[model samples]
Target: MPRQPLVRPGRKLGAVALDVSSSHRAWLDPTRETYLASGRTLGELGDRIPLAKSKLSELLRGVGLYPRWEVIHRLAAELDMPSWPLHRLWRQAALDAGKAPEWIDRSTRASAATARRRPPLDHDGLRQLVEHDYRFYAQVFLCDDERDIAVQDTFAALWLRWDTALCSPDIRAFAWSILRATVMARATYRDGRPELEAAVFDTVALQTQISPSAGAARMTRLVELFRAISRLPVTQLDTMVLLHLCGFTAERASGLLGVPLAAVRADERRAMRHLESAVTLKPDTEGPIT
Candidate 1:
């Protein structure tokens, strides 16, 4: 198959010619030359990077698509090029493609303004916040032997940076953001070590204390439900917990996760379906007879 040119030469969007950045083109030139000099075809490059041929072509031309950070990083590694230049070029391409959202700019400005006007949180208030949210934080970061350490580190970080978090107009949203960052950092640090990430569902199930008002059967079933929830992907599990357990609205979850509202809704739906299927398949040994 004939390889497509990176940018459609002389292509116009509507009546106006697409504005291509000279700097981005210049930055991409060395990488492009190296790939060709290596005698690798576009298809070969795509196969190596595991990107679609069409997508790879668009990326090479500095037009059409703005790939995610991982994709840019992969291409840079494959081409033996510096990742910083590739990141710059990809960001430029995204801007030229008009793919950058308006809200991103507005949000940046709003956050700056909020930071300027917000006051510091008092020590007592910070302590209260940590005490109230510790259980939820434990559940969020519950990985094998690291659970207690992760929770302690997260709270310590929160306490240290409570003033910065207080700068947000919504304190809860700010707290959630901090928690999400802490959990992600801990997860990434342990990414390749599966033993470290040991199945948390069983541990979480054991730690859950039943309420006195609940019957024994009801408590057993509740534990079973939590175990099932713990089996979900981290993103889906976090979304479900934030929405149902933490009593966050979809909008709040979206803000905390730094994802679109639609994505939060979709994750919630998928999580619920997964939990429903698990519950349906399990023997009803613990539930009370109707």
Candidate 2:
């Protein structure tokens, strides 16, 4: 089969290592039954295997293993939940916590009870989850399309920046600026994204102005602009948003992102190259525009 092009635009490629675990093996792998028998949560198993806690949690949640089962059979087979009197034990615990009686069957209340007893996240963990799951600080600029949701979901999945140190006023200011850019990009999607991005880069004074042109004309301009830049990959998109859309100085964007200034400069060049490529790749009107 042919490989798919890396379709997600504006994603950071190396933010989190894919090989976040020190051990090559997965406890959930069929060969690792002995390791799984250690009777630990994936988080605990992650510690022994030297996987990042966040990565481990993501894996478990992705596979539908978290929240412990409300059904005993599911708990046993799907989650490898403990075999001992699991149902009665957890059920009564749930009753003690005053959870709804109908929420648990008699056979599985014990698991729910155990789940209720768990404590809340620490401040750092809560922040990490927000950043990782929601892409709290990442920004995106997109042309109007029904497919825009895919871009948003891609950013949300890749975001992993969660340092409480960023709560300082200066850093918070920077974060807010990025967020505002993302919000503005979304707000303008129905109008024109590419034209907005071009104005942002080439004429800052024009960026905040929505042209007095009629809506359809404005949308046409935006579509033309996005089409002009479509062949660029993730790096150029990142640079364009930081420098043009967000109005960050090149030095400032480089410093905040910890990338070299030259890399940022190269990104602008690469973006132009992609625009040239896209212009030459004419669209077939008979096919759906993607």
Candidate 3:
């Protein structure tokens, strides 16, 4: 017996085929009408929207590709058009492709009200940005408590300096600069003193279960290593941690540290030498010096 095709030739299963080349033309009609009513050329529209001219052409021609949610939102904001229509189209496109929509759930009405009330730097936007970057900043500081305090303080400072930050070409970079500076300043203040008062290993018992004797010895060595790292000069330690541990490039480390590239490299070399000389491992001894 011959099995029939689920979709017969020349007959779409639905009102329109979900394919980009076919369904996109109809789906994009509303947006296209809105674009035309605005009395702007494709290039002019592209200038305002985040999409490129070529991409815009493809979109208008009913290409199946969907723009990111942020791009869609930006388009709606710039076009002075309601966002729901575009969002619906995007959702449908995703469904047609058998994939989940990459939309971040947020209240559209609330967002519109926010725009009407003030500029984009409201409490919600700030909170979202901070939450997204919290882990990155935490890793850089290597202390959750200090990172939290620093993030809060940095946001406070940024709010006060919002006007200046808004004028920058890259707002994210500007915000990061302020946050990094605050975190580094806090770190600098705690330098030359005992930052870690006690052993900071996580769950000795868990490690002991894996290898009882070796686990205890490794824990002691780790504590001593951390103590040694704490005793290093602020510059060397900051450079070493940012470049080596945090996986930042030399250029990025230099920018964050407000030092020259040569200085960062020099500090890294000095830091390695200092650590090797400070922490000695005796062949007969089982662990590092405490």
Candidate 4:
């Protein structure tokens, strides 16, 4: 009946709004659906969990500090749903919510000290999948040893939570989330958004030898596209990077991203739509987005 400590080490009463990421919403949405399906009143569930109704409301709504995995485990058992998937989803959301790595380690099979010892199955395959995607994307922002450390840290985090990765409803999405978090943590940002200026010069830049007037015009268009692309959600941004900048075919991108073919196309469409609306390059709406 007593609310577990409302504040924990590294999590204060009024931290910034990190819980609004799509990853966090996906993490909590299933539990909400299952709880609703069970048709149980908040009072009833609260009583079973032995937490105050007010505290229960916050957890269900994903308000305040991130919910402890212990509480989520209890809630899942009480609801008669498997907790493993939720456990994986919860940690994805936690990373997005700015939970410290040490804190995340506590909710897993081992503490940070021993977490890296237990690598999950298909270690090589998973590592290659993640490493390839990371290197290509991270090259946009990181270089040399920086990129290597970023990749190393990503795999280390994966090793720590490989069980959860395996149990997730979508292992690909879960692993991708970890990679995104790792790279974004160290990426350069402009005005609080990812600074993707490095990418502007990657695939589609102006001719090296052009008249000053024409070059200036082309450079302006590139900057416009750059700003728009930089502001995209990471989901669409990843797709754009692969399909446009890296020149991967959509099928190849689907394979590389470990998402459905439809998902890859949908991301491409959404990103292109945003680009078209945001930039009037060459005064041609029919021009290529890439």
Candidate 5:
């Protein structure tokens, strides 16, 4: 009699074939040597990666719905390998294994609100800017109390370093750096990439009045646009959010981000080009932008 493979639950819907799973496992084959360098039993590898034996076997064998990108990330760290390349493979495998875009999107967002521990302070000069920036963070993080904490921490850090920031060539830029770092630290990551998936819905650019039953083609193109916006380069993403969502001028965004005005414009062009490519991806299926 022939041997049958183990069936993973939740994968019965558009599940990936066993060979695809095996190939993905083979791609991570190096983890075996990194595990023991003399080859490793699944039990040994599981303990080394600090994963449950059953779960580890499922991942190593790709016998289940693909594990979350974070799991692969942790495994990479355990193996002392750079995670970026592995991240790409993990994403490809997930997509090829029939993970829906919606599923992937949900998996990529932060599961919980961020906790910012710093207490708030009153800074007269930065107060208005802080309020404005708070709205931006609120839109991005989409959590009430926790998003407030993130903004409060940014302002508090800036106030503490006010003197140092004042002495810098660009105080706003210095403050911007602090804000950027803090927000990124709290941002959700997938396959080693920080994600701003919230921009798909909450961003001001998405505020146009369009009904649910709007033309099917237009809506489809709109969906593609949202997808592109969510994946822009970090700098470009920030630029678009500032310009369209936050109503900031190019000069103002340049000041807040510490990027030169020319570069900011360049990123805008690049972002638009990327969007164009995505929306026109099939050409035949493309619809009017307006």
Candidate 6:
């Protein structure tokens, strides 16, 4: 009888499982040695980089760099410290000497083969974005340049393609921006429509939060919010997108942006203050501005 190949269990989604191959371990040793030359820990390297500790650890271990030495080497390389600074020197030399890294061409070819296998964005975060705010629809629209036709086309596509695997947290965050842009553009279009007076009604309709017949008064309040948003500067748009539309808490938004939580909170407050100053209540008995 012919010998049978063994099938290994897969790692949990959003995480890299350890590769127990001997060749993988061998490849990581040199990287480990490089770190020893630079003198830093993997945990220390993780602190300076964008990854969380567990993720950093996983990135190292999956490539057979775990067990300390390999971690340190990657840190040194990531930080451009000595020992593994050869990579940096090579980059600089390539620039100064009018050449490229020796592995660049080869690596690019190899990377292209594996690139398609990777997932797009984290799943859990994506679900949260959809669950929390209708504002996300606007953000996504904006990324595509706030064009109604484009936004609607994209939304129609995503709405049709919705699935559980598409709900990663990272993917959700990414989509949040796109949705915001898309909704904003749609809102802009609605503002100019003969039947609609404010972007809020458009935004609400974009999210499907209420029926089309939700009444002019409710839509007017939504319009008031949009007006306040419009008065804010473009520089603060990211904060507004994350805090208001995406419905990310201050802490989570801060973590996602790699800024201090206080900064996120302060920006949220500032955005709200600006909105409060901009809104004006119309009399209940009065008709909406046509």
| Per-model TM against the reference | 0.34, 0.36, 0.38, 0.55, 0.48, 0.33
Candidate 3: C-alpha lDDT: 0.52
Taking all chains together, the TM-score of candidate 3 against the true structure is 0.38
Which candidate wins on lDDT? Answer: 4
TM-score winner: 4
Ranking by TM-score: 4, 5, 3, 2, 1, 6
**Per-residue alpha-carbon lDDT of model 1 for 156-203, expressed as tens digits?**
444434544555565555566555544554453323321212222333
Off by over 4 Å in 2: 1-61, 64-206, 214-218, 276-290
**Candidate 4 TM-score versus the reference:** 0.55
Residues 153-177, model 2: lDDT tens digits: 2222112111212433444333333
Clashing pairs in 1: 6-61
Who is ahead in lDDT, 1 or 6? 1
* Model 3: per-residue Cα lDDT over 236-282, one tens digit each: 76665555444567887666545678998888888778877876644
Q: Where does candidate 2 have its weakest 10-residue lDDT segment?
A: 22-31
lDDT of 5: 0.57
- Report the lDDT tens digits of candidate 4 across residue range 1-290: 21122222322223224545655655465566556555566677779877877787777777777777767777777876545445655676687678987888776643221222334458657776557766876766666565675666566555545555666767777777777776776678888887766665544322232234556557667667777888898779888877766666889777656789999999999998988788776643123354
Q: Which 10 consecutive positions of candidate 4 have the poorest summed lDDT? A: 2-11
Please provide the root mean square deviation of candidate 3 (C-alpha atoms, Å). Answer: 20.9
TM-score of 1: 0.34
